[model samples]
Target: MIRQLPLVAFCMMAACAVPDYRPVRAPIPAPQPEPAPQVNPQSAKERFLRAVEANGCEVNASNSAVILAGATLSQQDLARILQELKDEGRGSVAPDGTGFRVNTGACA
Candidate 1:
């Protein structure tokens, strides 16, 4: 009976042992991105006008005609742009004296 009592006391002491604890790691968040800048697209008429201006031609606002010099836009490039404008129904290009008259539907 005395030996049984000692064994029982040891079992009770074992049951009162301290518990171990561990820290848990947390997850990181992602960074936010900045928005892009806004840009306005150019119209077909605007593009054609820019091309003529780039070639150093004089644009007549009164009749929408561009005075083409000897060193102005090449014949091939002019023809291509004129054709494109015609196909899109935006305008037409026709020979007017020394320069070419451009019939742009809307200057806007």
Candidate 2:
């Protein structure tokens, strides 16, 4: 019993000993950047018409063409608007009988 007492004491001492422990933290992930806004083709055309109006021209878009009414714009101004639309892959613009026509390619 005396010999067993020492073994029991050692077991109790081992059980009461402070355990080595450390707090672990998970790694934080980096924040992702926001995606760019998508451009709508119909809205693009509308905005183009508004821009033309602001530049002293009246413009409207139909199924077959973009009609210019009331105000007359200089060839340079007209060309600039048409080129911008074309470069955006929106459509091809050509002068029709009384107005300009935009043959749209596809929506953005």
Candidate 3:
């Protein structure tokens, strides 16, 4: 019985032994981004008038719409011409000017 008790105690001690366990590591978070700034330019009519000024051409008033000097003038073509002038940085066709002379429908 005494030998049997020692064997049982040994078995109990072995069962109660502490286990070795490694802890798990946590994951990292992602980074956030910022928004871009906006660019506000002059209106089409203003840009076209600027183009005309940059071209150093005058706008003559007559029965047939304000005529653009030198080139064949069209209402729709005015806006594109102005935009081109702005890109090239030509002439003094600024939105903030003393006189408000426009060919009318230049923006159209």
RMSD values, in order shown = 10.3, 9.6, 12.8
Candidate 2, 1-108: lDDT as tens digits? 998999999999998896868787888989999998996545434655554544334233442123333223444555676778668755443455344434442221
Which runs in model 3 stand beyond 4 Å of their true positions?
Answer: 1-66, 95-108
lDDT of 3 by residue, 2-98 (tens): 9799999999999779675768677666666766667656666454565544543444233224333324456666646555655655433435453
Per-residue CA lDDT of candidate 1, range 1-108, in tens? 997998999989887775655576676767778767776566544556665555443334432334234224544655676667668765444455444444443342
> After aligning candidate 1 to the native by TM-score, how far in Å is the CA of 38 from where it should be?
17
* Predicted structure with the largest lDDT when compared to the true one: 1
Clashing pairs in 2: none
lDDT of 1 at 95: 58
Model 2 CA deviation exceeding 4 Å by range: 1-5, 16-79, 83-97, 104-108
- Please give the CA lDDT of all the candidate structures: 0.53, 0.53, 0.51
**Using Cα atoms with residue i matched to residue i, what is each candidate's TM-score against the true structure?**
0.29, 0.29, 0.27
Clashing pairs in 3: 50-93, 54-91
TM-score of model 1 vs. true structure: 0.29
